[model samples]
Target: MKLSGCNLPGITVMVFVMLSSSSTSAITNFNVLNFGAIPTGGTDSTDSFLKAWNAACGTADSTFIYVPKGRYLVGPLAFKGQCKSSQIIIRIDGTIVAPLDYGVLGKSNNWFSFEDVSGVSIIGRGTFDAKGPSLWACKASNSNSCPSGATTLSFTNSNNIRINGLTSLNSQMFHIVINGCQNVHLEGVKIIAAGNSPNTDGIHVQLSRNVEILSTSIKTGDDCISIGPGTENLWIEQITCGPGHGISIGSLAKDLKEEGVQNVTVKKTVFSNTQNGLRIKSWARPSNGYVQGVRFIDSVMRNVQNPIMIDQNYCPRNENCPGQVSGIKINDIVYEDIRGTSSTPIAIKFDCSDKNPCTGIKLQNVNLTYLNKAAQSFCSNVVGKAIDLVRPNSCL
Candidate 1:
């Protein structure tokens, strides 16, 4: 610890950030409670935690809400703004279980919800078990009583969030969702899901900015990381992904209009048995959006299907590929220093739409070995390459 200097614009922020050189005081105090002591089995501990937190913090900008050891069985704990930009050490040696019934809320509920807050962290070695099979099965069967479960840990309309060293398993939907948030950091977390598990994505960040996902391991059914619309300045580094879909940006603007993703960087990552190593997906329709300033650098890939895919005609409802193109425009994308063994021979496929084609693309020192055969999409206006394979078909 050394002395630091800074100019203060706001006194509250000075106290909030605590950048003073001479102080030895820890910024936060612990308010510890064990759910096991409460004798609650389920998300009830979570509900109680919220109530206690509300009383403790009371909209005072933030507070450190500490949960010490013990097993807490809870379902879908919603945190709107209890610990905003504060040290929230729900320390390890504890389990937060989502009740057996609260299915993934793709359309409705978020298991762990955050809204309109900043400088918050959910840290330490804990487990968020979304005991989500009973409801998933019912929803899969099209039961009218079943609700949508799109994401397990969903962050909505917030900023400066951090999730570190946690384990999440058995999600009814996407393992983690960062939606409409900014300045988020996820470090040293492990998320697991089955390969055939429907929509079980590892980390899906949408409509956010300034996000960092580093040193995480993800195994899931869907893309390990899916960057969606209105997202910018995202960095993902040092991650071990797969037994799933590789890193992806977009499935952009599935049903919405005016969505754009920009300034994303993925570096020093490892992929194994994934479908696509580095992928960008945009709709086939002519929509009003653009993805710009994207880079994937220094990554290792193994046994991935279509190791690199740029699909503009994403999610075709009916084949014969439509003429109503997506309004989304992609620009200034770069992939550098990538070596990979692709499970499919269509190692690299660019499906840029005939209308509103991709622009300002650069691929340098990329070598791909695909076993699935090759079929290259027509790059009408595409330019630049150290591109190895573009075949979208199989060797068979």
Candidate 2:
């Protein structure tokens, strides 16, 4: 069946088609152009994209919402779920540009949000072009006057989600966020922003479980991948990160009753010219949380500031941080086959909390150097074991 198209001034004509039978389910294509989206890069295509999404969500058959190759301007969009069909795909071969003005986007925290979705896949070579230079300038000039910028893409309360082969650039905030999601897979994703862009984390995972990030490249200002509270069974592999804060687990212990991150593994990653390579940080305050069973293996670092670190006294600049020791318990952490060159002399630092010290910290096959000299290791308030060819080894 051929679906009707709406006509708008300066908009191209497109058609949607669906073919179905009693024995066979049809794959419907819902092109955004048919819903009054003008890809001239001038008109706001938010409402038109929403119309296409609504149609795709209400269709009983499998649907593919297509965004053709063009520059389409859009604003904040939320694609809510409980879709009529189990399978929904968004195929983008175009660039979606955000508005330059943050005030026009309002206080929304996300540019594109997918919530309560299952069996959904967003796959393409498209780009999310977040025009964030103005916002960054606003933030750099005056901290308090800067609005809360929006993440480029967000998935909330979603399960069985797959995001692959997409590029997100110059996000005002985080490039992508996976929150309260399960069984999500992100592969071959590219995230890029200025190294000085404030708070532009590559990918932030929070309150999620069973997530896999594979074969990705990220360069941003903040952490390449930040695993926040309540994440479990996360496997990150084959990632390349640089000009950013490297992969990290938590700046936790800020909340009174924060959830713990457990059973996370990062392997076969490379960090170049980043602030930290593999770090687990927590605030220096009394909080109820724990991080356990985490592993970092087979990683390479080049000119990284801190290659392997565990800082329990994490306090950002300009804040009057407390002197109390962190209450979070860290245990059963392992770092193996981590060979790196550090920008600083102190490559391996385990500055754990004095009150609740770290336990069962194991290091194996770790070789770190600085400027053709052996790097140093600093350990305090931690008990651990090192085995098999540890270089520049220190007391643990």
Candidate 3:
């Protein structure tokens, strides 16, 4: 089959010639260096990257855009596609550095973006370095003049994506974001940033489904993994998170059009020196959303504050949140086989919404303790049951 032209924003035309299954298969490799990409790390290579992406997107059959080892400087780049071929792979072994000046990135919220694409795979051990120290310092010092820094990597309105063996460092904002996507798989990824870096979430999933995050190590400022509104069927396992806010599903109900999240399972994760471990938080405002059928199992926490928390009145920075009860509903959640050392006395806190109280919460074999003292559980407007060997004594 000969795939033809498609239109994309900022792209005039895309021509792909895909081969049918019955036909002889051919794979094409487009190297970024061949497109005048300078690996000296001084010159901007954004145009070279765009050229390679365009070539791969326009090619017929399976295509690989290769970035070999070296340091290459680039600004914000977007790979938008409705490619002729379904298979477009980006194999990166080089380091891609973003400009240190946030002003140069202007208005673009992402350092590298893939949008409206399918059957895309980004693999290979590479680094995406967003020189974000200056940006972080500006934000830390209350310099309101700083521009909003960009996420290191983002996928928007894309599907059937696989990202593996990538290292993201010092991201200005979130390290990775999957937004309005489906059937995405991320494995063996690493994210690193300063604990005080503002808004530098490790991985954020929002408005997405059928996402699996496995064997990832994240050390960042904000939540290691944040599941936002409209996320469903998300499976996270074997994640090592530290020096961050830990994993969270939350701050929902800020938007009325937000959709509920369901069927999220996080298992076999470890949190060390994190602010909060295994948290579910929702804003105290009137908005329609719900979270249900969530499970956290076989997780270990060390020196974690708020080891197990459910805060329905989650107002950040004590911003004087409205007194209105949260409209988001929380139900059918389970925390099992969680053993942790808590940094605070209240290791388990369930502060549910006054209007829509959480129900069907189950705790099984949960052991959390503070230094030289048994941890405590605090419950408010929560309905739950404790299974066998529950520690810290459930207060439901």
* TM-score, structure 3 vs. true: 0.93
Looking at model 2, residue 284 earns an lDDT score of 87
Residues 160-217, candidate 2: write the lDDT tens digits. Answer: 8878889999998999999999888888899999999999999999999888898899
11-107: candidate 1 lDDT, tens digit per residue = 2244344433335354443343532224345335655676655543453434445555566765555776644335432344477666554643434
Candidate 2 lDDT trough over 10 residues, lowest sum: 5-14
Q: Residue 244, candidate 3: how far off, in angstroms?
A: 0.4
Q: Which residue ranges in model 1 land beyond 4 Å of their true spot? A: 1-43, 59-62, 82-89, 102-108, 139-145, 316-323, 371-381, 387-396
RMSD of each: 6.2, 7.0, 6.4
Error of 3 at 373 (Å): 2.2
Local distance difference test values of all predictions, in order: 0.69, 0.88, 0.88
How do the residues 1-396 of candidate 3 rate in per-residue lDDT, one tens digit apiece?
111112221111111222223342477778899999998899999999999999989987778788889999999999997998788877788999988676665357998999999988887789999988888888788877888989899999999888888999999899999999998888889999999889999999999988889889999999999999999899999999999999999879888668999999999999999999999998888788999999999999999999999999898888888667899899999999999799999999999988899999999999998995788999999999999987798898
In model 3, where is the ten-residue run with the lowest total lDDT? 1-10
TM-score of each: 0.82, 0.93, 0.93
What candidate 2 gets wrong by more than 4 Å, as runs, is 1-25
lDDT of 3 at 394: 88
